[model samples]
Target: MNNLKREFDASTVAMMRQAMNEVVADRRFLICQSVTPLEVAEHILEQAASGERDLDRLKISVFEKLSDAA
Candidate 1:
């Protein structure tokens, strides 16, 4: 039983580390994109102005969906 618990804990830790690495890689890729953050922010603001409600709320919802997939 102790061995099983140890193995499960190790596996969970490894998965968490891999997820962290993937997030870092994704951020790097986004930063490398030609589009700047200001441009994206402006777009989001436009979207909000067009009756999209709170822009930050939408962003959080989208990110949560993506995180679930990961």
Candidate 2:
């Protein structure tokens, strides 16, 4: 039982470390862009929440806005 607990703990720690690495990598990408990382992340979350992640939908929306502006 103690051994199993240790294994689980080790697995959890490794998973957390990998997740941290991914976040750091994402931060690096975010830093290169014009928008802040937090804003980008929030937009991603909002898109997921709204189920509006389709690329075609985003493209059409942008095009519509541009046409309306013209």
Candidate 3:
């Protein structure tokens, strides 16, 4: 239903936002301004979709991605 779809969308957005905040607050990510927090957030969401929901793991995954980029 449309309502179910809307709810899913809302939850996804909330998750992404929370991930973004966590990434931004991380000391490892605080010094980097080249990549947008949104990009990192998307990466986190992708990892979560792939069944990795643990915050620490997500943070490490994002950190590694950014490290590789740099």
Candidate 4:
């Protein structure tokens, strides 16, 4: 999420924010606590950078990546 960052238009940013929030909520639900690991956000940002625009797909990809990492 460092140098990979690039400017996105307002709507894209909003979608990413919505996806991030949903991802966080889903993660919390899975573990039953208010915990959001930095890697989760980082991974989602990376996925967004990689041209993933769909909110649901972005979230599922994050969970899939996290599960693979675990």
**Per-candidate TM-score against the hidden true structure:** 0.34, 0.30, 0.65, 0.74
lDDT of 1 by residue, 1-70 (tens): 1122222245444543444344334664254445444544444444344444543454553344344434
Positional deviation of residue 60's Cα in model 2 after best superposition, in angstroms: 16
Of candidates 3 and 1, the better by TM-score: 3
TM-score, candidate number 3: 0.65
lDDT of 3 at 10: 60
Between 1 and 4, whose TM-score is larger?
Answer: 4
lDDT of 4: 0.73
Identify the runs in model 2 with alpha carbons over 4 angstroms from their true place.
1-33, 52-70
Q: Check candidate 2 and list the clashing pairs.
A: none
Which lDDT tens digits does candidate 3 get at residues 1-70?
1122222356656766676788888877877766677788668767766666566677788888778776
Residue 10, candidate 3: Cα error in Å is 9.2
**Once model 4 is optimally superposed onto the true structure by TM-score, how far is the C-alpha of residue 40 displaced, in angstroms?**
1.5
State the lDDT of candidate 4 residue by residue for 2-69, as single tens digits. Answer: 78548777887898889777876674436733335677777777887888888889878877776665
Q: What is the lDDT of residue 45 in candidate 3?
A: 62
